[model samples]
Target: MDNLGMVFGLTGAAIAALFAGIGSAVGVGIAGQAAAGATSEKPDLFGKVLVLQLLPGTQGIYGLLIAFITLSRIGIMGGQAPTTVQGLLYLAACLPMGFVGLGSGIHQGKASVAAINLVSKKEDQFGKAMIFPAMVETYAILALLISILSIFGIK
Candidate 1:
């Protein structure tokens, strides 16, 4: 039973990692395309587009954090097995951050693409354009918070 708990915890963490990585990959890829298009039209906008391209990276970071928390809760942090129930709780803890980060990241990419278009026309609008994607990042933050709280609640 104890080993089973750890297994569930590790599996959930792995799933979170997978989803988050995929989300970041897709989001960044989309952003990269937008950046390329913008840069091709106006080479001077390269710097602006680069920042947008990097924005999606936060999703990966959040996923990593959730994975770490889950592992820690499973006692992988201390090189021992956690209590059975704790491990099960740890698995549950990882879900919100994983899904929310995944969904938000993909949505952010759309905003990034729009921002790139805005940048193409008015360089000064780059900052304003970023607001859209930045707002989307709030969802990731909420998810991260929930994961952290859930891990703590597991005792």
Candidate 2:
């Protein structure tokens, strides 16, 4: 009970890394499958498929960034340990990145998969096809900004 604050902070950091990482892994896997399928039929689209597959990978980076920030702030990486309230605050801060990363990552992967299919079918539509997956990244970016701001804003 007494260690609740630190526990919360630690858990938040863990979630930032774990959930986001899982999301990226799943997303990449999904995109990779589509990419492979597309490439098998149209080998020339390898570059396009690769780009689409990597779009979801950004969420993992965002999650990792949030995790690093949380850990650093919580004094796990260094510095003084936060109080119970501060720890809980860290947890709250991490939530945006964790949840958003997970959702956006998976959705982006789906978007990428569709994009890959489009590219496979119409090589000239690559520009428009890339936009769909890129749009999904907007939410992940917003979440990342919120988490970073929250972490730094916390005293």
Candidate 3:
């Protein structure tokens, strides 16, 4: 019973990292496929496509940051353990990042694919091509901000 809070906190941390990591993996994989196809014909475009493929990976890093913060906050890494209520709050805080990361990562990957196609057709359009996928990244950044703020705000 006493450890319930720890369980919840750990679960929250896991959710934050796991879901976002899954999202990044899928997103990166999707983009990688597109990149491969695009570069197959014009190997010179490899550098450009590689950048796009890596963009979706930011969400996973954000998730990892949140999880690390959560763990430290809940005393999993050090101090006193959180109360159940605090643990629940931590779980709530992590939700935004988990859900948003998953959604944005996938969508960003799709967007990246489109951008890759655009770049493949028009190499000079690479800057504009980057914008489409970068826009999708905005949501992930917002979620990361909210999760970090929420976690820090929890007493």
How far is each candidate from the true structure, as Cα RMSD in Å?
1.4, 1.1, 0.7
Which pairs of residues clash in candidate 3, taking residues 3 or more apart in a chain or in different chains? none
The better candidate by lDDT, 2 or 3, is 3
lDDT of 1 by residue, 92-120 (tens): 78888788878988988888888888888
- Model 1 is weakest, by summed lDDT over 10 consecutive residues, at 78-87
Error of 3 at 136 (Å): 0.6
lDDT of 3 at 132: 96
Which digits, one per residue and each the tens of the lDDT, describe model 3 over residues 1-155? 99777778888899999888888889999999999999999999999999999999988998899899999978889656988998898899998999899889888998999999999999999999999999999999999999999998987
Q: At residue 97, what lDDT does model 1 achieve?
A: 79
lDDT of 1: 0.83
Give one digit per residue, the lDDT tens place, for model 2 in 42-87: 8888988999999999989989989988887677786557889988
Reference-based lDDT, each prediction: 0.83, 0.89, 0.91
Off by over 4 Å in 2: 1-3
Candidates sorted on TM-score, descending: 3, 2, 1
For candidate 2, the lDDT comes to 0.89
